[model samples]
Target chain A: HLDLHHYLLLSTESSNIRIYYCFRNIMKELQENFKKLLKTERVPVFLTSSGTGAMEASIVNFFKPEEDVLIVVGGKFGERFFKIAKRFGLNPICYEIEWGDYPKVEKIEKYLKENKNIKGVFIQICETSTGTFYPYKEIGEVCKKYDALLIADGITAVGVYNIEFDRSNIDILITGSQKALMTPPGVSAIIWNEKAHKRLGVNKRYKYYFDLEQEYKNQKEKFQTAYTPSVNLYAALNEALKVINKIGIEKIEKNTSIMSKATLKAFEEINLKPLSKNPAIGVSAICLPDSIDGNKLIKFIRENFNMYIAGGQGHLKGKIFRLCHFGYIDIFDTLNQISAVEFALNNLGYNFDLGKATKKAIEVISQYKGA
Target chain B: HLDLHHYLLLSTESSNIRIYYCFRNIMKELQENFKKLLKTERVPVFLTSSGTGAMEASIVNFFKPEEDVLIVVGGKFGERFFKIAKRFGLNPICYEIEWGDYPKVEKIEKYLKENKNIKGVFIQICETSTGTFYPYKEIGEVCKKYDALLIADGITAVGVYNIEFDRSNIDILITGSQKALMTPPGVSAIIWNEKAHKRLGVNKRYKYYFDLEQEYKNQKEKFQTAYTPSVNLYAALNEALKVINKIGIEKIEKNTSIMSKATLKAFEEINLKPLSKNPAIGVSAICLPDSIDGNKLIKFIRENFNMYIAGGQGHLKGKIFRLCHFGYIDIFDTLNQISAVEFALNNLGYNFDLGKATKKAIEVISQYKGA
Candidate 1:
């Protein structure tokens, strides 16, 4: 279902960086590549906005104001969609789940059965707040059974996980530039199929800026945006797409899985607890002991080794630290970071075996699979 | 009213590019510098979107459905505002002008005088479609007399022209990253003063992603956005701001004016007609001869010299080609491009004297004054 080959490289001046007009044409290629990257046959429209903007656009474009939709609220990102839906006047039915936990397909089906007015279902492939990867494929199947639209947020999941697009039955999939794409922030994409657009036109003229239909056609034929785009970001992403093509997305996903499992093994040795019941391949969120201040541990690692590890947000703040495993990093880098954190935690008054974590990480890395 | 000083540069990794956590903090500096660039003391909030998105945000944030707003429709960019205002359910009273002609100050004054319910007025400082520059200072003064909030779209004018922000009496100013900022496109900024926020509390949560007030506070105090920002775009803009700072803005404006005048003089000698009644310093849009296909002339110059000069968009298409005078390019590059076009036109079954245009350009460049 996924084709990782044939990534097109844009022609630059090669001497200096400048925004070219022909980049508009190259942008078409970007959309196509993103379609392939997302493993969808749908038309993927790129917006000069954040992933959150795409999240908002997906709702307003497909469902009118006051329409009822179902949202899976697991953590920060899932909650964002729920909030956006609510802000736009949609009656969002929240299917609540614990932080670092995923949705039950049967529960979603039960909700759909209970509410026949529900037009669409929204969920995240990986909840960034808790590093939890939901079974989006299962959810998609359930939504299809009820003839409801399934919209998936793959912002942190796309290039890191090779989700079978057709089997997943996702009518719409969203991702951003700064995550697994290895590009900068600002630009995000909404990939949607005929199944979604046929029922509802790509967009109406009401929300003029975020009119996905007009913009999709505009970029396709006009070779220009309805507005000026971030040409520089596209230029950088041109390079990133080439890199992704060379490494091959499946290989990248395989490595991400390997690295995530390795980090989990290392954490077991160092007594760091992974918070997620279904941990994602993109990042690992480890809950620290009540006595150990995660923020101080993070500060120690940054100051000593100049490496950054993110702290948890929302309710989990100061209680967990996240280690990233996707984009511009490899298994060795992960091992090195775990080694740094191990010593840093020790320096921060947390008693942990220093060298044992790295040893366990090596053992996991040696058992790696796939090309 | 306008002060252009103090640009903050961000710290980057010495080896390679990676989205850093501290980048969230550094993005605050990017917003502050944009305020300085726009010469507004008010809070400037950035959106990971294009100028058009900011335009829509400005309209929806301040005005509810059925509110009356004044729009100056002159060219493609101007019509865009009218269209956006119309699409967003605002009653837009258009003060229409011919393409390449600016708005009459008295006409806007009369519209405000008659329409007491007009809450805001929208105008372009330099309409990109026709390369026309309006006298925004005079327009702003007239809007103030009626207590109308003046929203100026300076996407193509802000970095190229030195406008007195406070003296202009403009309440809200919008600009984009691509134009004179010399950064790649995608990100845009909205610089607003207390006058604008006093009547309205910035933005309601309805448009959650573009809730300016919430973003303004989140970026100022929390050092993070409500959503993920295009951190890499901020990184590139950081370097561009440093470059602009070292060169100084007033000098850039003076040089831009000189280049625009020189371009005008060159076109006059080469039989190219200036399209705009009030041509901007940012670009020179030259009307082509009827006998010559302007598109073919542009194609010839591009193919032969590998240089780009943009042809007109919308109604002016195939009738005019634009000569850019802002960002990265110098006077010599302008003369070189002009010379290339002169020969390209002559070769394309047109009659003209050779080297005369470049000679005329040098005469104007020599007369440039101010540091």
Candidate 2:
């Protein structure tokens, strides 16, 4: 299938007229569909890079230099906001938390109350590094009470969960083409409310490429971007988003939840412990015993079973492995992942029930009736 | 073809280990082939965005705040450099020139002599906005003599022309995937010599997404990027670069030259004057008669002939139209463009000989047989 698509569209001129026209409409329609999916009136701006680009765009456009912003750092993605804010010369007050923990609304409120100049609170809805699903809705209420904008990185949380943008009062919501969107990476989407737009008024410090205002203006006027966008990627994303919309966000959420639950259940049957204190539905981080090598286990699974999963990032390396149950995945995929893990563990000389894990996963997944 | 590839590989998890492993080798091989195609020892850094991202990466990574740089502004891209430098707090001296005119090397030398603190000279090898190709080799010499870093935006130049990176003394050279690289617009490639790398030794102003040093380090260590790249785009780019390598750069240059010649000849037959005095080989900017509206002409071609061409940008809008003969384009495409223009003009009641343009085009394109 990859070869087929590559043969058809990959060889065309990058700026082909047909592609430009088709993608222009695709981008416009995609944004509209994204608004519908988020149940928001605010239009999502499509950026031509990864989720990190959207994160930086939000910081650079909405906040002023040296303006105090509160960053809730629980995992790697949370740390990203801190780094981007610092790079943009924003005064970021880090509200640090443990890697696998979630941010508390009270703590965020305390930070806001103590710091009168805090203009915004930056955080991740799902910290992919540790598979923790943060309570952004509660934090949003705190930010609202303090009149501080809430910028949530929903890269891993958007399509996997029901992210009602307007209802949740998220001023700036960001996501990427990868993750639950089920498209290849390259484009990121950022949807912000009028309050965030007002805050970004007349900003002149942003570089040409990342200038959100200019991109917004261009997109508004011509359904185009500030730079040459990836037309092929846009076409791919349009189709992916259409599939998600057809499946309905609620169904997707339920499916992802079921998969996550089944996978966790299977892991428990095999005596594997979940790593995150508050794990997200899209991925489950399983803590490996100190005696077992997590890296070796992952490598063995990839080599022997032809299955791939994530290893722990940063400080948690070699101690945990991540199993994904995100977009384009179903119960069968979850069972496969569990079986692979069981096989890998047994191959690594760890005592684990081989067939018991898959059986447990199947039992849990069998209860799901909704499509 | 696009459907096939999309069905197979486009739906995979972006950070999947198998995808990561496969694309890591693809990225490495693509860069190696790119270096060979450029015939330079300098390594090209694969950036996960459009060329504009690469342009910003160069500025924020190499120059410090309030540092002085010289920008030769002849077209929109040149103005982009000016804007980026200002955003990074650099004091940029704009050496302004007419949009269609090329910059003189002597003038650049004079500016460098007068401005002793100028740290770098930024210019575009082929400014896409006006189709003007500057004499970068001469400018590189001037920069070398004055000990100023030469940063060239080669977005529309690299694959279309034989740009000798090392011998030409170019400190920094940048290109995009959408232009001559024959790939979708997502990734950008930047190749720089030791001088530019040494200048970027310890700069930290760039955000995580655009941090060139970290990206370079990561790529050098494990053939990986600092971010999750678009795996499908990389696969497509690797294949495209392999094709380019097989054809050889010199032959591609000749083919592009023939196409450009054919286009210009066709334009001349229709009594349309070339807009740029020193137009690049990739595109031709044709001045429209005052009686005929350029925008209407372009729209007519799009609506009637179903062809895609560019109209004049910025101040030149409604005055000129652009004809692209860039990557993945051939003599047949050039003929089609000329025919469309002729058809559009004749249909719009502009008096011109029918079939004359294609005849003139064929006469010029027939001389090239190397490809």
**Which candidate's DockQ is highest?**
2
Per-residue lDDT tens digits for candidate 2, residues A1-371, read 24534523664745465676666787788778888889887877888899999999988888878899999898899999999999878899999999899998888889999998999999898999999998888999999999999999999998889888889979999999888888888889898988888987444775568788888887877889888787777767777777888889999898899988888888888788898888899989999988889999889988887788889999999999998888877778788888888888888888866789899888888877433
- What residue runs in model 1 are displaced by over 4 Å at the alpha carbon? A1-21, A200-206, A222-224, A369-371, B1-21, B28-32, B35-40, B202-206, B369-371
TM-score of 1: 0.91
Say which candidate scores most in lDDT. Answer: 2
Please provide, for model 1 over A18-44, each residue's C-alpha lDDT reduced to its tens digit, 9 standing for 90 to 100.
Answer: 245566656867766765665666666
Question: For all the predictions, what are the DockQ values?
Answer: 0.36, 0.57
Report the C-alpha lDDT of model 1 over B156-247, residue by residue, as the tens digit: 88788886576678888888766787765667778777778875653343577777777778776776776777765555565566667677
Angstrom error at residue A173, model 2: 0.9
**How many backbone clashes does every candidate have?**
6, 9
Clashing pairs in 2: A1-B4, A1-B5, A2-B5, A4-B1, A5-B1, A5-B2, A5-B4, A5-B5, A8-B1
What stretches of model 2 exceed 4 Å from their correct place?
A4-8, A368-371, B1-9, B13-16, B367-371
In model 2 chain B, the worst 10-residue window by lDDT is: B1-10
Q: Local distance difference test, per candidate?
A: 0.78, 0.84
- lDDT digits (tens) for residues B264-367 of candidate 2: 88889889888898989988998989988988988898888777788888999988989888786787888888888888888778888898989988887766
Give the docking tier of candidate 2.
medium
